[model samples]
Structures are given as structure tokens and as C-alpha cells.
Target: MVCITFMSTTAMAREAPIFLVAHPDVATRGLNTDTARAIFAMRQRTWPSGQAARVFVLNNNDSVHARFAKEHLAVYPHQLQLAWDRMVFSGTGQAPNLVRDQEEMRERVATTPGAIGYLEREYLDDSVQVISME
Candidate 1:
């Protein structure tokens, strides 16, 4: 049992310290990177469980946003912007909600139902639930 516990703990610790967080009301417990990318890219509007997903993000120039895009989503910030722009122009999709900073991101995501956004470990609080990445 001790070995099992240690293994589990170590496994969980291996995840990036940054996280995908959501309003407490969202039904999802976790998401894969592809699903996260799809949501952020505005290709998917709803969660896998059919809940409406209100996506949020920091400014494209924000270091957190850039890191999240590259390290988490395996994409570039400009690529995501271009995709959002193309979708907006073509009438197929809309951009994610933009927050001015991590503080605003925490506030908005904590209050908006079905909302999802990324944040560093330090910004976490009880208002938002961390969505473990699959």
C-alpha cells in the first residue's frame, strides 16, 4: 500500500505545476490536451459532457498565455490568434474571453459557469476547481 501510494503521488507530481481551472459548476473532472486545444482554439464550444464551455485567456502577449500555449497545448500563441481570427472572419467561431491578467482570470473563471482557463499554481484557490489533464 505504501508503494502504491508513493507511485500515485509521484505520478500526480509529474504533471506541470500550471493547471487548467474552471468554475466549480463545471461537470468535468479533467480533459485531454487535444480537447483543451480545441476549446481554446474555438473549434469546440461544448465540453465532452455537453456543458457549454466558456473559454477564457490572457492577452496573447502575456508570458503565461504563451507558455500555456506552447508547454500545455503544444501550439504557438500567434497560431492560436490566427485561427481565432480566421474563424471570426469566416463566421464559424469566436475568440475566447480575454482577461487582463491572472487575477482577472481567476475572478472571471471562478464566477462564470462552465468557464475554463489556465493559471500558475500560485493563483489557485477554492473558488475554481483544477481540471486534471488526461
Candidate 2:
């Protein structure tokens, strides 16, 4: 029973809710899944308001990165990586900036104009704006 409880708790942690956060200066309040996907995939270069969009991300192997890609962007982390790789190889685009962890993600997104990233709920604060994804 104790082992089962531990496993369940770990699973819950892995599935914790993640929010799409951006620099407070970004004017957009919400984004569709497709637009969000494009931005994270480095296909879209600017926010709806015409501000240049700068995307930040955790390492591809991070659990939070995996969860955000799957749940919010509707793509796997591997698929996103492949898209980024193709862009870089083709010299058409650049990959999102990689942050070390949620703390760094929050700090970068909060400070950089038009920056966007995802964070688990506990890391969210007024320093950034939560952009609803639908």
C-alpha cells in the first residue's frame, strides 16, 4: 500500500498543471493551440500584437517540458525538437532559448519583452502574465 501511494504521488507530480506564461508587457491575453504550437515550434516569429515573440524553453528531456509540449501545445517534445532541428539545419529559424529550470524560465519570461514559456502553477506570479490556451 505504501508503495502504491508513493507511485501515485509521483505520477501526480509528473502531471501537474502547467500554464503558458509571457512577459507582462506582451499584450495578448490568450492564444489558440495552433498559434501556441507555432510559436513554440519557432514557426511564428511575432505575437498577435506585432511584437516580436521570443520563446524560452527548458531542456527537451525535462519532465515539465514534456508535459507542457503534450498538454498545452498538443505536440510531443521530440516532435518539437525535430521541427527546431529542421529549421536550424535549413537556416530558416532558430530554436527557442533554453532555460535551466522553472525558476529561470519564469525569470526570463518575466524580464524579456514578448518572451513566452510554460511553468508549473507554483512558479507563476505577477512578474509574468498567464496566457490562456484554448
Best by TM-score: 2
On residues 6-34, what C-alpha lDDT tens digit does candidate 2 reach at each position? 45677565556999999999999999999
- Screening candidate 1 with a backbone cut-off below 3 angstroms (N, C-alpha, C), the clashing residue pairs are none
Report the Cα lDDT for residue 91, model 2. Answer: 97
**RMSD (Å) per prediction:** 8.5, 2.8
- Pairs with backbone N, CA or C atoms under 3 Å apart (clashes), candidate 2: none
lDDT of 1 by residue, 2-76 (tens): 554345774676544678999999988989999999999999999999999999999999878998999889999
Candidate 2 is scored at a TM of 0.91
Local distance difference test values of all predictions, in order: 0.91, 0.93
